[model samples]
Target: MTDPVSEFSRPNVAAGPNPFSLSALPDNVAFVALFFQRDHYCTNCRSQVQDLADRIEEFHERDTEVVSIVPESVDHVEEWQSRYDLPYPLLADPDASVGDAYDQPVRFGILGALSDFFGRMPAVVIVDRRGDEPVIAATHRGRSTFDRPDINELIAELDELRSA
Candidate 1:
């Protein structure tokens, strides 16, 4: 895989027509949008969506917006909403084309040189009006995820951004 920092932070990839810019959302707000790996689709992160819901106040304290981004137009809104108890928007990225624009898999696992191929990388992107680069949540190695986004860690990074 390409360096996460360079892939997401570089001026071109971050601001390109692809890779949904955080500022593109309403109010140029800072948003955390979710993306999953490959065809493993789930609107709500069943294991932790509820946990995210209960602890959403922590994100609210940081003035961060939380939105679940599903790859396909899965009509499981009510099911996921009820299951996760989420009070946030669940946006669809169609065929995950939007995510493809953001991540061009350069290499993956035994299957090296994957940029030629296409697949979704499990991640969360932090988009804001601060600059071109968006804060990368995690670029999991297939079927993996960086569970429990550390609020304090995120707060620190944003603070550094603001100061810089």
Candidate 2:
């Protein structure tokens, strides 16, 4: 299996641009926090996105770019962004191309398998982009509906990477 940090080779196509290549991000971007959501229909996912949206400035203060990726159409994602008043960028991966590249869990174990069959397992990936090197500093995966990465923890990771 490939280590999470080494997965920079994976393609990252964003909503606005032709593609938001991770490797191509400017050096000034200290880190990137990518939140992967199942879809706009998931209540838990919506809540999570809202929480991140509420703290968009906190992320920018740390020199990190925050983006949420949803496995839905561009129209749906744009609607969600407007509804939530999200300040960060939202990328549409209708085909889960980025999710597949990051190996997002499509099958949520044995019990939740049926419900999450088409769901992209929730995840938060923090990549340090200081200087010329972009390294994965942390990776969090939610196994259940209630599970999520702590925003405080993400902030701490950014702080730690900045000081390193």
Candidate 3:
């Protein structure tokens, strides 16, 4: 099977030298917190990313990279980047291929597949890169639009990973 982390690559709209890929993170980066958004207009998604941005230093301190992926075109993600001025990588997954590869939740079957707004829920995947290849160390697949982990919960997960 193809490693999704290696396969996933996208243009970084926020604070990128260029494209961001899980397989090519900086050597110092031990983990990657991949945030999958429901859509471009979800206020909860926006707020979550902003919250991550605000506490980015915590991630950095643990040698983790915080990445937020939106299943929207580059233009939309660019607007978000411009508006939020996020400190970490803000990626645009126009086709949501990466989200699909990571098994991000999609409800309502056909309708959810047709419209991210209606079906897609939030998800967070933590990739541990300490091994020879990146591995999915943890995941939080939201059952509801609001069912997602808080910043502190994420930090705790990272701490647990580091200790392990």
Candidate 4:
């Protein structure tokens, strides 16, 4: 298995340069909010992306970049970009390599490993870039389909991190 990705460069299907990476963030960007999606058809995942998109300005105000990682092909993710026109970066992690790197939860053991829809849950990884190298500042690993954090909660976490 490939090692967990501490930093990644992937095709960006949303409003930004192509193939966004941790190294390519603007100098003003202090944090990166990586929202890992469960699958292409997850309603909760869709809602979360939309919610973030609507509040992207808040992240920008905090010098953060909101990136949504979808474990699907670029073509499939493009459909989402077309529908929502997200203001942030929407990346396609088709092979789930990035998800596995972040240890995204998988349930039912072998069965969950076999199918993402059945096993893979959502995750939010906050990467702090204030130091010499980017580091994981916080993580919210969902235990169930509905167990993800709220938009305000994410903003609050970023606010706290910035203050500290």
Candidate 2 global TM-score:
0.80
Give Cα distance to truth, residue 84, candidate 1, Å: 2.2
Q: Please give the ranking of all candidate structures by lDDT, highest first, separated by commas.
A: 4, 3, 2, 1
| lDDT for each residue of candidate 4 in 4-89, tens digit (9 for 90 to 100) | 33877899999776898888888789988899999999999999999898899999999999999999999999999999999999
Task: Give all TM-scores, in the order shown.
Answer: 0.55, 0.80, 0.95, 0.95
The parts of candidate 3 lying over 4 Å away from their true place are 1-6
Compare the candidates by lDDT and give the number of the best one: 4
**TM-score between candidate 1 and the true structure:** 0.55
- C-alpha local distance difference test of each model: 0.45, 0.71, 0.89, 0.90
> How would you encode candidate 1's per-residue C-alpha lDDT over 49-148 as one tens digit per residue?
5555666666655556665554544444345544555565554454555556656232356553343223344555554433455555433223333343
Query: In order, how many clashes per candidate?
Result: 0, 0, 0, 1
* Model 2 per-residue lDDT at 52: 84
Query: Tens digit of lDDT per residue, candidate 2, span 127-156?
Result: 776645566677787776567878898888
Compared with the true structure, what per-residue lDDT tens digits does model 3 show for residues 57-162?
Answer: 9999999999999999999999899999999999999999999999999999999889999999999999888887788888999999999998998999899999
Residue 8 lDDT in model 1?
Answer: 26
What order do candidates take by TM-score, descending? 4, 3, 2, 1
